[model samples]
Target chain A: MLRIAASGDWTIAHLSAADGELRSLTAGPVKAGRAVIDFSGIARFDTSSAAVLERTARLLEEKGLRVEFEGVSEPQRRLLDKIDTYGTPDTSKAPPAPFYIELVERIGVTTREIGEEARGMLGFIGTVVSAIGRTAANPRRFRLVPFVHHMEKSGFDALPLVCLLTFLIGAVVAQQGAVQLRQFGAEVFTVNLIAIIFLREVGLLLTAIIVAGRSGSAFTAEIGSMKMREEIDAMRALGLDPMEMLVIPRVAALTVTLPLLTFIADLMGLLGGGVVVFFMLDMSPGVYMSRVQEAVDFWTIAVGLIKAPFMAAVIALVGCRAGLSVTGSAESVGAMTTRSVVRSIFLVIILDALFAMFFTAVGI
Target chain B: MAQKGEPIIEVEGLMTRFGDHVIHEDLDLTVNRGEVIGIVGGSGTGKSVLLRTILGLKKPDAGRIRVFGIDLAELPEEERRLHERRWGVLFQDGALFSALTIAENIQVPYREHLHLSQELMDELAAIKIAMVGLRPTAASLYPSELSGGMRKRAGLARALALDPEILFLDEPTAGLDPIGAAAFDDLINELKEALGLTVFLVTHDLDTLHATCDRIAVLAEKHVILVGTIDDMLRSDHPWIHEYFHGPRARAALAGK
Candidate 1:
């Protein structure tokens, strides 16, 4: 019979044949019945290994041999009891052990899944492009409800801030223009310069930037929340065209509202410039108004209004597009909303410059 | 009983691949009218993907899906929209609009698909809310104000707003207490009976399966291993089935019986 030797560390190492002399002295003989399994140094037992010990015990019992546990540990005894309660230890189909390799394989699989999901974004972009084309073709389907809501929320509601911003900008421009004109004893020319510049470029640009920051971000957050909650999915399931139901209304609303807001911003800016001329340049309201009338033509105001719809379209498109890009995660919604604001502002500025150049070339 | 007519939803050889990995392969399922079917699987088992594919949110690389006899792959965008108006879905977490009141949420389907007066829409919305067992006072509250179970009930109210014949629910009782979950199950059973709706329920809750499912399809080993009643599942010879049903929770539930 083979027996384990105690190593004094609560763990027994295998007994070698050279240790037979000590084994013989301890047990008086090396017969199977005289062999005592010392579990005194054994610790940290598991179910599978405990099963092997139980099997050995059963074999010894069947042979009419008494196996004694001289110093069996309490933990080892508890492990054995657990094994008994839990039934068989079928270690026949145990999995392979290289844990890091399995982890890497799982990470690779997840990475591939995410990569595929990102690639699917291109399909969504394509859908957006097709939606835009369809909207252009059948403008009638783009209903007035979203447009009305957006106008009230994004345009009409934004009037106070737009007016205040334009007024401040007009005052600053007039003051600066007055400083230079004063040097030449032509301070009244500041009125014409401020009015012309505002109607031509500053009014529309300022209004667009405000909308890009305000309404554009609002659209992103709203849509992003919907995407996260799967309301977008519910809409699709109900056979509702999400673009028609969600996007078109926003686009129409911004488009209708921007032009109206721009008109208001332009008027406020002119009034602000007139006030500066009246106070700083000491020009009368009549003289300043007459000069503005002479320098700032209908064409300048028309050019500014023309840019309004374009700016509105850009803001709405960027906002809605970023909103649609949300992927039903809280982080994704936040990230996409930020992207919407950045994209809207960037597009608005770039388009403003382009319109400036175009109108400049056309001698507007 | 399923009639001899076409199934409401038919998915054949549904294979969806994301980049180099395949989510599912050679999958086939048939959902008939007026049948309540439950789909059960571990997390990340493509159950949600399967539902999304049926709704045309995802286009499977190699498969055909037909909803209400209209082949999704073959239908044009207009036709797809027309088919979409016939079904309803209650997403996981209920997915109610946070900005809208419960009544307003229910009014969404009616406002989009039908040309009804504001008074009529309000009346219908109220009726739908009442049908879901929500109080009239709760109708004016926003989704953020509602509890998890209430949100789900409100979402069900919205889904029923269109009088849809088919309803898909994804994890309807996911975050509720057991008592609340059982109550939701009772609501589902009542609604199904009253509306004659064909329900496609996706969940991992064993209690939900034992209580409400007429038949359950278990996804395991990258395939559907079993589709049967609770008794059949308990008696199954499969190792996974034995392990699942003999677990502590199942044992406790059985012991109480």
Candidate 2:
């Protein structure tokens, strides 16, 4: 006798318990003349349950058994019929491309993005330069309040952190130079090492990198959110120039403050170098101060000082352009803000390098 | 097809409070098998709080919540999960995992509960995506790519993944346009009957209540003040209910019926 039996809820939760029983029925008793499938004990049924029942019926029929579904309710049959209509859905996902192809694709995409961004940045420069020219033509049109507000936030508020960071870095450079000079029996020359490095390069480079991280990301996030909320579009609709109202003030604030911040950073760095070498080496604080003072009088200090405003302009322009490029969504704001910090930092380092080569070539 | 229609869920003397603000007091509700119950309330009335409390997401301050003839609070963790597997809850928003595709989102519960092959799980997910009225191509799309209406449908598909006998919907029609809302109503009604489900729907959409609910529970003054049909709600003298049913938007909803 070919007897098939199913009992229990046969719902998704209870289907696991019924799995072994169903599997046994599907594999056992094939090539039967007649089979009786009983569903008398089922209390609950759903699409999954119906799927199991329909799977069993098909398996039996494929085995050439004349299947009889006993106690099959109308609702149960209807659900089974529903599943039967969409016999098997296509669930195939596209396979990922090969490694080299993917790598090439990534390189192409990155190159294209850099080119597009370069163009966009140039366009932003054109707009802001014209806006500044107009503001210069009529000084009354300049937004002094917003410019002061941004300067207070990005410059004055950044003092303590910049001082502490540059001071600590200068101390580290002095201590290490002293240790290395001690091996050469010329520990006194640690003053030359610390003075030349901090005044010529480390101080302003560190300040510019810090500004890129702090002020650049902040500006991008702020203006990106405004763009995301259509506030930029609203300002345009109201005939207020975003370049004047938003961009000019931000750029002006950073340009004015970054050079000042860089000067403060150089002072604190020299002070930090003096303190460290006075403790670690035979050089007196007076001698260390003399070397640092002489270095500042040369065009070396001027090179670092001049790089500050240019780096600030780079950070400000990148941040504002990235912010303006932001489409609607939190994701866009996040991506463009990150891009702002990265691009500005990269450009700052490259600009410092070019300035270094120029100073050498020009005998500064 | 045929159920005993026994009381599947019973809550009595329910109390809920957030800090000093009391949300529910001396509240009682019973959900019978295979019936759609709508919970309606004003803006601050805690209709969602009650639903979340019943789903065990929030702890009720004081109450007796017996589901499937067992005290939920007293049951062992494993034993309680067995009872929990009998129902599914859809949140107000889709709440689909942001990083996962629609297929992966639907497969999450199966991956947790079932020992099936990935191929079978994918097939089941595809079925669910189709059953909830989404195109087959939607399976590969992420939740971020979907519109608000499509996201709700995707959430419904995830809710239906386990084929539970009870479905808990939180504002299923909240953001849908009129035609979309009506089609959703029809879909819910059809699914409830076809799958022999007991639906507990919390909604602000007046049309959804008219079309899908067998009984409406009005929550006011920190309790379910009344539980009855739309006609009964219309006939009642409760101040809020009177204005709610006779209000301009309510009249438009009723006329659209």
Candidate 3:
């Protein structure tokens, strides 16, 4: 028989020390035989230390020894028994895969998720298209209140920021253009450069990017939180189509507002360019205005206007789809809102590039 | 642990206010070691606020709160933390950190307070998980994945990680089904007896009060109107206390007990 004496404060405060000592005692080179763990010298006892003692006994017992407890008081025995009942917990969760295998698995999962996302987005677009068609077929079915509310929210509320940003970009462009043209003794050409860039590209591009960041994120947060709360589920349960009630109003309002905002951006950009030319080039506002008129025709101005409604529709669709796809959590809502802004901005830039190529091929 | 029947928590002339809304006024109570004390009240009587104040999460406007015979508010920061470590608290909804697994949550207090090997901590976490009646698989699962009842159990396990001498539970049975609630009551009773823990329970469930509480404290008119055993509560002639103990639901709870 092997005798082991357990002593000292066997509580949580001294748990690690006690555990280490007990483990070392069990690890010594003793033949497997009847072992007695005596606790008579123990000054204090608690469940944590009891667990260590029980674990040590079990380890010894598994190695072909009969383990017995001696000198345990009644309360201490009850605690020891309580820890014994729980036993050693099984922590046999699957180990992580090797790095290369995990990489390959992650790549496969990401590819599949992207494919599903594309299919879902296409399906959502189709639903929105049909809902718009239905509303157009019956004008009375259109929700006037929400449409107007969204128009004010996405359009009117976005006006100041869009104008301010486009105006600053226009002024910076004209100032830089004038400096470069002056080196070539053609400072007068700055007005033409400003007119062409603002009317053909910058106005609608800047406005679209701004609205995508502002209104797009708002739409996602509003709808995503509602989705998290099961309000979307409740609406579907009540037989109300979310496409008609939620998506159509927001999309249609953005489509109508983007072109109008682009027009305002174009005017603001010209006014800003005129101010810079007048101040820096010693050109009068009258001369700048006439030069702008001489540089731009209906085609240059229509190039940006034509791309407005398409980008607006894309942004609104991306935002609404992300919102509807939100799972039931605050974290998911935040992630979806961020995805809405990022995706809408990306698609707007891609759409602008496509429109630029189309207009170039058609000799616009 | 202090000797049984020794005062572990003492509150005198306590007042809690939010702006012009007074929650508690001149409230007094003493909690002895090794007792399950339940705090009960009608809606909007500040039961949770009182618990928060006692936990020092909120400062009482006017009062003295002495825990383990030390006035917590007057103690230095380092010493106050030492006193605070003697107790554990379970919030209304098991506020487990969403990012951590249940095992990691249980290990949090241990990691903060003690120096132990990773392997030992993992063993202790598994033991805690089993002690709270959770399946072994629950150790690896996140808080969001667990059901309402399982989350509460996980929260209780985390609270008990340090082997705290006192356990403060807020509405422990509020969202549980009747069967689940009864099981929880039994678990609390068992843990308290085995650990020699003083339990401060804030609950609305009459069945829980009947099954687990050693004493009941009733809150009314922004103060504790009475504190006693169930028999004393039943004998009280105060309108709210009389109606509370004689209500139809109370009758059913009493019959079940």
Best-fitting candidate, scored by lDDT: 3
Model 2 RMSD vs true structure: 3.5
Which is the leading candidate under TM-score?
3
Clashing pairs in 1: A10-A41, A11-A41, A147-A253, A238-B84, A239-B84
Runs off by more than 4 Å, candidate 2 = A1-5, A13-38, A41-44, A52-68, A130-145, A229-245, A325-332, B1-5, B62-84
lDDT string for model 3 (A197-281, tens) is 9998999989999999999998999889999999999999999988888999999999999999999999999888888998999
Residues A116-214 of candidate 2: C-alpha lDDT, one tens digit per residue: 878878888999999999999999989999999999989999999999999999899988888888898988777778777887899999999999899
Worst 10 residues of 1 chain B by lDDT: B115-124
Q: Chain A of model 2, TM-score against the native?
A: 0.86
Clashing pairs in 3: none
Better of 1 and 3 by TM-score: 3
TM-score of each prediction: 0.46, 0.89, 0.94
Q: Cα deviation in Å at residue A150, candidate 3?
A: 2.5
Error of 3 at A210 (Å): 1.9
- lDDT (10s digit) by residue, model 1, range A90-151: 21323686989999999999899768755765565476568768977988877677668777
DockQ (Cα-based) per candidate?
0.01, 0.51, 0.56
